[model samples]
Target chain A: MKFFSLLFFIIGIQFASMAQTPESPAIVFGPVFGDSKLQELTYYKINDIDSVQFTALKFYISGVELIHQYKTVWKEANSYHLVDAFQEQSLSLPLNVPTKLKYDRIKFNIGIDSTTSVSGAMGGDLDPTKGMYWAWQSGYINFKVEGKSNLCKTRNTEFQYHLGGYRFPYNNLQSIFMDMPASQLHVVLDLKKLITEMPLTQKHHIMSPGNEAMLMMERVINCLSIKK
Target chain B: MKYRIIIVILVCILLSAFHMATEQLFVAPENWPETTYDFSKNPLTLQKVELGRKLFYDPILSKNNSISCASCHSQYSAFTHVDHDLSHGIEDRIGTRNSPTLMNLAWHKSFMWDGAINHLDVQALGPISHPDEMGEKIENVVLKLQQSKKYPALFYKAFKDSLITGEHLLKSISQFMLTLVCSNTKYDSVMRKQTQFTTQERNGYMLFQKNCGSCHTEPLFTNLEFENNGLAVDPTLNDSGRMKVTGNKKDSLKFKVPTLRNIEFSYPYMHDGRFKRLSDVLKHYTSSVLQSPTLSAHLQTPVVLSSNEKVDLTAFLLTLSDKSFLFNPKYSFSK
Candidate 1:
């Protein structure tokens, strides 16, 4: 009987180890995609835009520090994940930390990591197979922006913004922080503000990180000032 | 008097709980150090372990329902791809790097050839939606798994819910992988004095410490740091290792220090699966280190290994092959 109990105890312990999950929090920091009018097509030329297509649009957001009552509770160590709203079906940012304690403010950066990009075949946010990560060319998509527009010529253009540079002054990982009450743990990004002032022509198909991806990502993230 | 009585009751309860927990938690192997992974956050359970095993064998974890983790990482091959230079994914798409063997992964602070993935639980998402790999989204994969006949019950058993979130999927896989402890190698036997290395293997062991021991350290067989072991860049692939992530040009040509355990079988070797044999790897190390700013200091001087020494080194690497693990029914595919 004692031997049987010992066997049962060993089995019980083994079962317990299997249930432990790492505390990586996944939060939806996505578009306020409700009742927004869809726009048209056009070429946004390289030097400001003649016409271009935007098939997908997304970029990195990192350096997120969560605060409660102006005191930081938790902040991501190295949080720069590509949040592509255009191509990806849903935007769920899973944070890697123990979230047993509640958080009020969730601050993060908006760009890809130089380390994450070079690392081969990452599993989560940095999965290279996503095409979000360039194949041996650069590294992480740093930022990915795509959408089709109607400026002229082609009806739709496939614009892919793959921004990332490990070579000297080309680093574009952006830091972004947010303040919010625990109850109002909502992050809303408006697409219209990111692309343009209003009537978006097919001139804003920006992909990859450069002046366009950098400027556009800055605008998109900045436009995301807390809805106080 | 009442306070003292309450304190005594609390002490008794706490003592009993602590005793049970100590028996429950793994007492580390004698003389072996602490594990990097903190198990207190998520306690192990039999139901969860069984659920994890089921998930490990299931293809529902992948995007296409065609390729699973087991597709690239086979148990027979030390949880590494057997023959491929580069790992092939769904639709026969080729990836940039070779799959590393998965054993004693709990000691690994980071994963992948460049040490990109810090945690183990969320590592599966890399393969699931990679365009050259699964090419499907996690949301869609979750939907598929949620709708599947096998997963709901498995998820419930693992997490007490069948909601089938990505978090649950990743965690289950981590659970299965963490259980893969490879401490029964011949090297381990020699350490325990159960068996001694043959003269050739013993010679090879000494040579290994002299040549490869710094990066492929003893006990766990890795220092867990990235290094440039001096492989000339493939003109076609042109991978710059850790430099791509840091954006610092200094880390160019650096790759994660791969474990030499089971090094006999888990080849075609290196990140891109360039070298087919251990001799070729040694030859490259001894003679062909490309001059780079990021070259590891250990490989600065040429390793003077005679042809006989190469044979001895190969013999030592072979001792790491734990046949029992390769054929372990506990880790193999099951329903």
Candidate 2:
């Protein structure tokens, strides 16, 4: 009788432990629009500006908040990550969450944090492995814009727009909110429009962060399309 | 001349929707802390990582495909080239600093002894394009990977497409590197309470905590911060460490703190590989640290140790050796 009771106690504990652990959520991010003809995220129509096929899209969601409807509700600030096309790999944000680890609402910064640029190698979206990191220059390509235009002085212009500055005069990370329920959310990126519509000059290859990096990065995700 | 044009062409072709590639999983070790990498944005799969590993070990990354990352970053010696102080890349070329050991990379916030490269996924591009290293163009590397027979299938499996572009190739290498975790040493066992430290090791551990543990932290054996441990600059190398990247006058001679875990095997210590033995390293810490504007406050005062203290610190460092990781078959040649 004593042995059976011990086994039952162990089994009971295992069940409780399993119930406490939360399932990892799926994270998917990519270009939401493939071409200009495919509608954009904002109210604006897709068109070429000044004869440049400028695709107006948004990715810089300055903030992403994680809200947990389960357990006791909580929240975190600046959770949305920077998305770069030329130098960075597609992002995969981890979602394995507990109600406390996540909140019913998730708040995140859209551009690179001022602290991260100077602090050194950051993991994930900040890791140099993503290729957007600049070793010689001490900042991230917060906003990466690369495309060709026949109308510019150069036959085809490849513009590299890296916008970021942690110090005064160049902080580009922005904030945006989502009506995503207190539950899990999915953020998609349609990269197709990014390359198709943009005023690019071959002379401008943005490898580092600056006003150009910030302004261009903001424009890319300014009106990012999302679904709950 | 041709290289510049190809970069332009790739920039244009990449804009096409059909050219976009998928990302794959770059999973972290179980029970380990959450990884800094965001794999969902660039999902993890088998193809890209294996290609990266193959590319890492292959000679093709160099100008002549003569010296691969494995040339300097061997699996043995904790992936650091042990023969020379400064790294050698292509055509017997000499780099300015020692090639740092490569392991537990997923957790590391920076790369190179000076914390030069910030991310692991993009770190390879440095060597591939470094003048004295691989000396190849990123666009050319893409062309080479695209031409490989085994890589096309590998790319498709990882990214769901047959194309092997630079982004896909670079991402694949990042995947393999992310899997290179090294945390199974005897020291880790002690932390987990699975075993006890030997008398010598115990004494050594105490000495380390007192002396070197602050900079060479535990769990990872490195704080992953840049510090001027105070070695005078080598005129020939003229390396500026973090200052070169940040342009801050206060950040001179500050190299990234290296992990002391595999110090026993990875000889020729420091960013410049100036010391050959632990004794020299000890002596430098005790007496040779050159006072500079950016010198770490910890080493501001001399580190005085007795002869016995030196031996104990060395012994404690040995416990960081994880044989399984150093000789793991998975990390070795694919064959």
Candidate 3:
């Protein structure tokens, strides 16, 4: 009888511990071309004129923060996520905030910061093996979008943009903020907006971070929005 | 019971011996600025430094397995390419800029001629992936290291894991490079008040202070800032130096100010290795400074050095050479 009672007590403690831990809310990001969901190799019209198709698209989102009112209530430490359009699981980020806490806004950086760029090699999303690192220049490519477009006059009608620069005068890292509700949050990236804004004829191929890269990076910021 | 206790003590001793053999502490020179390298990320270890030395001397980093880092950065020449104006790498492919000497890197905020590399740990990627240099992808290098009979075991000992990662590869190389500290020159001895310079050398030291002290600084012998030294752009290379990285017109032709330490063996000088001798370098400073929009303000005023003063300055520059650093067997190949 005594042994059975002891076993019951231990099991009760385990159940109580399990009940105390809460499930984290999921923050999902959906990529789309205006109203339509994005698919690889799908033809899309930009400004209803230029026919464009994307083969690859990958970018980094870092320094996620939860803002209540005007002040920052919570900020994720060492927050870096690589979002690949083809990878379904990469787009969603599960945050571990308390269920009772309320947040009015979400903030994040569109690219890796200067500290991580110079912090040598890293693993996970910041790993050099992720095809995001520029082996020739010793910096990570913040955003990479590769595809073919009829509007692009280059060979094979391809357009590639590998954007990265941590130094001053051409630093391409951008910050974003959006209003949030007390429920599951969804962030959307509209490809049509980016494609329409970019002047494909005058300049299309942007591999290095410069003034052109900064301009394109600005368009990337404008394309992101909170979806209801 | 007594035997078991004895065995346990013996095991403890063995474990401590192994720990001592593997771990090492990085000690900075007294009165020097704190190292820019964040040691918390990649801690120093004797085993990792040894592994880095082996990798530095190995040609497996190159695509063809023909050229090693030692090919360009030989110890005798103060870890710089000696004769070639520009660095020669795999297949005798000529590079655009001269290979700079590698020493006192822990204090450096950036690397390369144009400061393209922001960290010493990531600097190896530049040469390894350059078309005219090693021309090997980092992934392939890791794969090769994983397959190598000797490297896997070495990596296991250093990193406590058999798997070779790009992070470990870079951090290990950084550990070896960090050990390269050249502070025991004759000038250092004078600064410490252990020795006195000869009359000629002393005179040269005065002249150096009056003319070049602002840029060259002291101890490390570099201000660690980029400057436009007024060298005419090479027609073939057309290198814009720091301007290429920043895309700012103000940064045009502004190459990093190199350390004067070991400058004797580190010639030919300049970004493109345009000056072959110390005399040529002095001549450019005194007589051949080309006026440009981006030229350093320090060089705007003419450096009028008499022939005798030039000789004195040269003698003082020679005092900066640390023979101990050049011939230190610790930095040489393990075998």
Q: Pick the candidate with the highest DockQ.
A: 3
Error of 1 at B66 (Å): 2.5
For every model shown, the clashing-pair count is: 74, 78, 0
Question: Chain A in model 2: its TM-score?
Answer: 0.58
DockQ of 3: 0.56
Per-residue CA lDDT of candidate 1, range B202-302, in tens?
99999999999999998778888889988888988999887755546777888889887788879889999999988889999889988788889988887
DockQ for each model:
0.06, 0.05, 0.56
Kindly report the docking quality category of candidate 2: incorrect
Candidate 2 per-residue lDDT over residues A1-228, each given as its tens digit: 999999999999989767764434434444544443333223222345533332322233333445445333433333535443321343445544554454444555566666555443344444454445553444565554444345346534333455555544556666555444433356555544444444453335555545555555655664356544
Q: How high is the TM-score of chain B in model 3?
A: 0.93
TM-score of 3: 0.88
lDDT tens string, model 3, B64-114? 999888889998888999899999888889999999999899899889888
Q: What overall lDDT goes with each candidate model?
A: 0.69, 0.66, 0.87
Cα RMSD (angstroms) for every candidate in the order listed: 13.1, 18.1, 4.7
TM-score of chain B of 2: 0.89
Q: Candidate 3 residues A51-81, lDDT tens each?
A: 8899989999899889998889888877999
Q: Write the per-residue lDDT of candidate 2 for residues B74-100, one digit (tens) a residue.
A: 888998988999998788889888998
**Better structure of 2 and 3 per lDDT:** 3
In model 3, the runs with Cα more than 4 Å from the true position are A1-24, A34-36, A41-50, A136-138, A181-183, B1-26
| Worst-scoring 10-residue span by lDDT in model 3 chain A | A17-26
TM-score, ranked from best to worst: 3, 1, 2
